[model samples]
Target: MAKDKLRKVGEVAPEFHLYEADGAKVSLSDLLGENRYVLLYFTSTEEKSRCDRSGCPLKENLEKLIELDVTPVLIDVDPVEEHKRFKHDHNIKFLMLSDPAMETIKGYGVYEKVNIHGIEKEKIVSTAFLINPEGRIVHVWEPKKIEDSIDDIINAVKKLKGM
Candidate 1:
């Protein structure tokens, strides 16, 4: 199925339902009630180790994210089992969710078919989104590499908080 168009800032963040690492269901509404903002990264499930190396920048900007009190969420577009192991192996403390059906990925408009090893493969765009207390997308990060500097995400959250 074709993914939805990229949403703009001020639009209500797209709602999603996916399995977290522990098999609990997590949705946008659940997060909105817990924190002032949510920081999300969409990644591929087939590539577990690579997801950390490519789809994430939290390692580089974790402190900044914490400073802004933004709840970090990782969305793995792979299988739930893969995500479970990935979370365990990495000792992930933040929210980690799996969306094997790609419904959530498409809802966020991050899934795309791209050339991989000379073959077309479905993958998520290396992107992140920050949603505010009101559920509006306040920031977006689309990097050439999955591991972009998270300073931007932190700054956006800080700015939003100051407003």
Candidate 2:
């Protein structure tokens, strides 16, 4: 956990390639220098209530983000089969990448071992990052709680765009 503190704002984001739910490879460089803001949300199994609650807000706010010209990327740390079902169930049209080994998840510092319901411990953190066109992190929401609203992300994007 502490070993993987997220890359700080103003630092060039680390680049890596991960397979999307649709089987396409997506790399950080793909978004860099694209002249568009990139919004990345690292998610869980999506079947879990925590994952659902964490992801629902982003889905609900997709239209507004699209309106703002922000490209939303969803990273699923669950298995491929689960990710497929989750994608179909949620009808998520945005980029959904799969990181089964959690290599990318740990790389981004969103992977953590936490106990949910006081029963089992697992990676339960939900995080989002707003990266500017220059590849530097402009804003970040590490371990974003389900109670947080999409407005938080939208406002941050709006603010970053003005910079």
lDDT of 1 by residue, 1-163 (tens): 1335766677889898888878898988888854568887876544346645555466556666776777888886666676678777776678888887777777778867878789997777756788887788988777655455376666667676773
lDDT for model 2, please: 0.71
TM-score of each candidate? 0.82, 0.80
Against the true structure, candidate 2 reaches a TM-score of 0.80
Cα-based lDDT at residue 78, candidate 1: 64
lDDT of each: 0.73, 0.71
* Top lDDT hit: 1
In the range 1-163, model 2's lDDT, one tens digit per residue, is 5344766778777787987777777898886655688887776654234545555666677798887778888776666566677778867677777787777777777766767778755473677778888788888776445337467778877876673
Off by over 4 Å in 1: 1-4, 45-48, 51-56, 115-121
Residue 122, model 1, lDDT:
72
Considering summed lDDT, which 10 consecutive residues are worst modelled in model 2? Answer: 46-55
The residue pairs in collision within model 1 are 45-78
Weakest ten-residue segment in model 1 by summed lDDT: 44-53
The alpha-carbon deviation from the true structure for residue 70 of candidate 1, after best TM-score superposition, in angstroms, is: 0.6
Off by over 4 Å in 2: 46-55, 114-124, 143-149
